[model samples]
Target: MNLKGIHHVSAITANAQKNYDFYTSVMGMRLVKKTVNQDSPSMYHLFYADAQGSPGTDFTFFEIPGAGHTYPGNQSISTTSLRVKDDAALHFWKDRFTEHHVDHDPIVELIGKATLSFRDPEGQRLMLISDEYNQGVEPGIPWSQRTIPAEFGIIGLGPVFLTVADITSTKKVLTEILSFKEISEVDHFKLFETGKGGSGAQVALIEDSEAKRERPGRGSVHHVAFRVADETELEFWKNRIEDSGMPNSGIVDRYYFKSLYFREPNHILFELATDGPGFTADEEFDELGKNLALPPFLEKDRTHIEAQLKPLQSSKE
Candidate 1:
């Protein structure tokens, strides 16, 4: 099965409004979509990406609305890395950071690449890698039209390492249910790859004996969304996961897409998301990210929701 790429990466955040500001104003990503968490409607579920909310380009936030924080550890968890186009864009991002008064560490080398590490308003650890080695032609359109030259854009997603208390169960699930092949194992880390390219082949899980289960709060990964071909492919995954006796929440409408959610042995949330009816579903190419869009269920309540929402800061350059 050929997986397309990452549909999106969802993370928990402390404050909805502050994250909204940091992602849009500081990071220069457009707030392509904003809506309340369907399960927890009191808090906002904000999405930041290139103008049109394209897959792989997206980093979403599920606001915790004044919750306590989550600490980082090596229990199948690590920093979230966003791949930038090249080193020059790293300079551009540096300048932008200085101009906007956003703080970031000086560029450093990590796993043989130049990376800039930083935190969002809620302190989620994020790193941007300025390397696109062996990247292919861009297929999906950019959600944001902010002129991300091919060399400086986020071409690939870095491997997400997990920390599981026991690697045996999760390992079985990955190999049998998810079809991941065990690549190699090192100290406190086990790597698995799909032998595919783009975003599909880039997921890794790590197990640590001393790892403790941590709750998802601000600054922690809410979920890692994997790609599926379409509804048919989604059904295949659903059946596979169910057959494996892993608890799974079937399909749920996510407005722009559909998804199924489950938790691995490490307790990190995983989402199986589709790749269709993208940003163009609600907005036109020319008008992407120009305004807030509400799903059909929330359209009637738009006025009330809009009234409760604070004004957005302008990011026009």
Candidate 2:
């Protein structure tokens, strides 16, 4: 079955508070959820996204303190690209960056579009492009404290690259199981497409022999999720991942979506997520990103969980 699209991308960060400020304040995304990392409750799992926390709109990060710095290699590949409304919007961002004194370079042409590149507080590379064909998405509340205008907020995440030592296994899973098609290969980099012509999903697999293993910490991407149509297709993917001898986490409800996780040889976490029971599941449209939201499974532990959390708020610096 063809996957629907991307779900959300998760990453690891050093300081939860700093990450929160950058994603919400600087980027203008809504802090859809303020919950602890399920595996490590001490750290947070901060989710940043557009209105309704739509799939492909989310960029999540976890705070794991004291994690050593990873050597950025050609294989340490992770890029968070965003789709914009038009080239005029790109000009708007250029002026916004200049007005806010944010460090950035002039727009660069790639994939036949003018794009601007910058980095987040955690050093994750970010790019923005005004591609009119992307899905129409509503923006969340205008973060009044943002350095940039809310009208030009990021719509959704785009092609995220993965630096892997070997692309064979991961490539197999992506093509054979996930139904991704190889679009092109340039300079030893393989690009795969998983969505429709324009608004679909894309990934670049860069093979690097000396690429160091990613140590989950600040600035590290947590995982990239592939979208499934519904629960039925999610089950199909479960059997497919298992049939291929890749160990996977069985279907787990994530409130906004259900997810299954696995790791490729290079150790980048990969998630197969279903899109449904969206951001509105636990929040009102007008009041999203205003409070903490707990998954149904974690609702009973809210009091205990809140106590364990380091008081944090998504704010602009």
Candidate 3:
């Protein structure tokens, strides 16, 4: 079975409140899920996405107070891109970034599309790529209450950029282990595409054999998860990864979706996750991101968990 496009990209945030404000107020994305990290219930794991928290639209973060600044280098998910409607949207964002004092670069053509690179307050490397006439995977609609005009609003995620030491090892895993195909190359960067290839289903590899490994902290991406159709497909992927002799976390119950996490040859974390039983699983659609949501397994520890977390309130709440 073929994998779908990206499911979500999870990064680190030292201050949940500032992260919330920048994404919701400045970037104009909707805060779709307000939950705790299942692995570490004391910290927040916030999810931002399109109107209904669609799979490919998810951009999430895990809070870690006092996290140090990330030192950019190799073997890292260096940059994350958000999908905008067209070239005009890219210009719209440039203007908006100026208005909000958001750090950004002028729009330019990259990998066959117009892109505008920018960074969040915490120095997260981000870009806005236009999906004008995009015909691969479907993009989610903008959130209803977003102050930014719906036409110029951000949609789903675009191509994720990976900076690695050696492209050979990572490329093998991407092609043989996973199903991505090498589509194009520009200097040190090679572009790969998976199911229904487009901006939404691509990853760019930037090779720097001499660079040091990245020091991940605040603003560093923790992992990139690709979308699988369902639990059955996720199980199938687990078997394939195991057969290929790659050590993996097999068939994890993520509450919202089932997942199988594995690290590629370059040590970049990759997760295969299902697309269903989403944020709506524990809360109503309109009520999403409004309250602290705990899965059934974590329900018993809700009191303790609540006590440990600092309040991360937002307008959605």
Candidate 4:
């Protein structure tokens, strides 16, 4: 089975309104869905993506106000890179971040590509990588209400960087179980790609055995999901992972998609998710993220869920 690419990256946020404004206004992404965390319905789980909420386009956050800061090191996904069109688009983003007073690093080259690194309000590490070779291949669906021009919009996810203690066992899990092929190595990072090796197909493993282990809290990544074609593929992977002695959460119906979650050798949570029954399953394409939608099982407790979540103000507000 071929694991297509990154399905989504889920991180933590301290303030829902601030996260909403930064992603929708400054970053030029579409807030595709608004829902509560399935396991804990009290917290808000927000989804941001391209217009259609495509598989690789999603970047989500869970609001946890008092959750302490993330200690970045081994066994954690430290950065989520978004793919932009080219170097010119990177320049545009750099200017935009400066104008908005966003905390960011100067543009740097990694793996022979121009990258603009930045952080959200909650200190979640993020980057914009200019895919010069694959320019315009995965263009973002622009939101008409976006402040930034459509041409410079963030297209989709790029390489997700995982800070690992070592690459030996992780490499086996990636290549043998997850279908990733080692593409290259730069500095201390070993790069792996799933499909044809472009944007949305990469995962970089940075080895630092002495680094401190990350504590999951605000500004930390909760999990990273990889895409499968359908339910059959998802089940196949679940069986394979189980047979290989890895612990998994089994198949879960997530309303929008079917998910099977497991921890890799480094203890980073990995999910195998399907591509069908997208964001439009519950809400219309035009009205997505406008209402707080919940799964059928949680519908009875909507009042309690809504009461626990703070009112999220969109950029337009």
TM-score of each: 0.84, 0.87, 0.98, 0.96
Estimate every model's Cα lDDT from 0 to 1: 0.67, 0.72, 0.91, 0.86
Per-residue alpha-carbon lDDT of model 2 for 210-290, expressed as tens digits? 756655446667678877878898899899888888898899887678889987666777888887877788888777766
Which scores better on TM-score, 2 or 3? 3
- How well is each residue in 11-71 modelled by candidate 3, as lDDT tens digits? 9999999999889888888888999999999999999999989999999999999999999
Q: Highest lDDT among the candidates is held by which one?
A: 3
Identify the superior model by TM-score, candidate 3 or candidate 4. 3
- How do all the candidates rank in terms of lDDT, highest first? 3, 4, 2, 1
lDDT minimum window of 10 residues, candidate 3: 308-317
- For candidate 1, write residues 1-317 as lDDT tens digits: 64455567888877666776676545656676766677755567777776446676678887776677786664535667676666776777776667766668898765445778777766787877765452432423333335334445544355565767777877887777777777666544566665354322455556567855665568888777877767888888888889888899999887788889998766667888887777678877666655767778888887887776665565543
Candidate 3 clash figure, as a count: 0
State in Å the error of residue 81, model 1: 1.3
What candidate 4 gets wrong by more than 4 Å, as runs, is 135-139
Runs in model 2 lying further than 4 Å from the true structure:
74-77, 132-151, 186-188, 197-200
